[model samples]
Target: MIAGGERTLNVVCVKWGDKYPAYYVNRLYSGVTRYLDRPFSFHCFTDNGDDIDPRVRLHDLPVEPFESELQAAMQRKGRKGAWRKISLFRPGLGGMEGQILGFDLDVVITGRLEPLVDAAPDKVAMRHEWRYEWKGQPGGHGSVFVFDPALHRYLYNDFAADPVGSVERNKGSEQYYTSMSAFRRGQLHYLPGSMVCSFKYDAARIPPLNLMMEPRLPLDCRVMCFHGSPKMEEAVEGFEAGLLRSTRPASWLKRHWRV
Candidate 1:
């Protein structure tokens, strides 16, 4: 919906504080450019734009109108920017009027993104949560998601009215609140699991299996999500920690995380 009939696919990612360097944004832009053939804009919503690539459209991180639900959850966990991602729900985010694809800095794009985004064009598009709950209510993952800023404005308005209540009801997960809010309105649909594989379940190897095979990428996966680690860097560096420990090398991750 611009001049000359050109389609705009606004790919957006957010960065705050020092968790991810600005270079991560640049790499994301590079990956997007490699796979997406259409005319598009890659935006970095960040607190500090000093080190980011000039090609990336840097916009200051949008502010929340009130206390965010994620902030309340983070107060006990001692983490910041947990709710910063939700700020993108603001109408016409960064003044870009089009469908938006939100990505976490840690994600690696593996294939063309158009199919999934176009699949549920009239609704919110997202991947399923950490697990596939066949018998229970559905949940969404925030690592990669798509929505229309102008149409899905209710998610922001309702949450702003009662951030605490929203947090408590969704069990303090912004992902849950985000998807459920749209789901109720019949405006949320999930991308196929084969298209958005998780590093932990799909790629990482267990002790006995680490010797059997290396991490395998799904043939149809468009994006690889590194939820709850090892993170993209950890996977690239070949290490795992805590309960999800695995020392097996993730050479494939290192190869894809950048290009």
Candidate 2:
């Protein structure tokens, strides 16, 4: 709430290294602009801002005491782990106030975003790890998250206090640490699965069937997450890493993943 009692949404993303280029951020801004039907400010925290959209508020990647070690750990896993994103959990992130909605650059927005914002307005919310839902595992997927910086400052404080120890205990997974920390305090909720889905698991057909039929976007999904293989680029054209991990060209993905 501001001077006029008007509340604005704060949409944020991070581009720490060269894994994704500037276009990823630019197109993400375009998607949010097209879908979110409310007043909002878009922000990007990155190591390089050379070619990003000018309308996006850019800030240098926030630093932490163990950033160097965190970076090293991420590299060890081929950059699959996003340890630096923990920095965003810090209070006053980019000096902005209010509830924050975050997306990984690899996600493709497909439907209305308001539902996601309204899902868990006060408590910290994230997508339940889809892969482990069947096992009754409790943890969050980092792709999409929403929280108030004021209330969730402890997320960063705890990590900063024991970065290395936390990494070792969580098996170098930031999302694991984040989800369990909030869950233990009874302040964590999972966004509806139909809204945010894994591109590989939910959208694409399983295995051999994928070879014959192109991936189909789930009818009710709002954001499709490309966590591992066949990222937006590879999926748009087509990708075939192997029998188990593969996808045919997704025309719908091509239609939405653009600036």
Instruction: Tell me the tens digit of each residue's lDDT in model 2 across 166-189.
Output: 777776777888888899899999
Taking all chains together, the TM-score of candidate 1 against the true structure is: 0.90
What candidate 2 gets wrong by more than 4 Å, as runs, is 1-3, 66-80
| Cα shift from native, residue 52, model 1 (Å) | 0.7
RMSD of 2: 2.0
Q: Model 1: per-residue lDDT, tens digit, 54-170?
A: 888989877676745446556765333357777788877787887888898888888888787788887888887866455466878788898887888898888788876777777
**Residue 11, model 2, lDDT:** 94
The 0-to-1 C-alpha lDDT of every candidate, in the order given, reads 0.78, 0.86
- What clash pairs does model 1 have? none
Q: In the order shown, what is each candidate's alpha-carbon RMSD? A: 2.5, 2.0
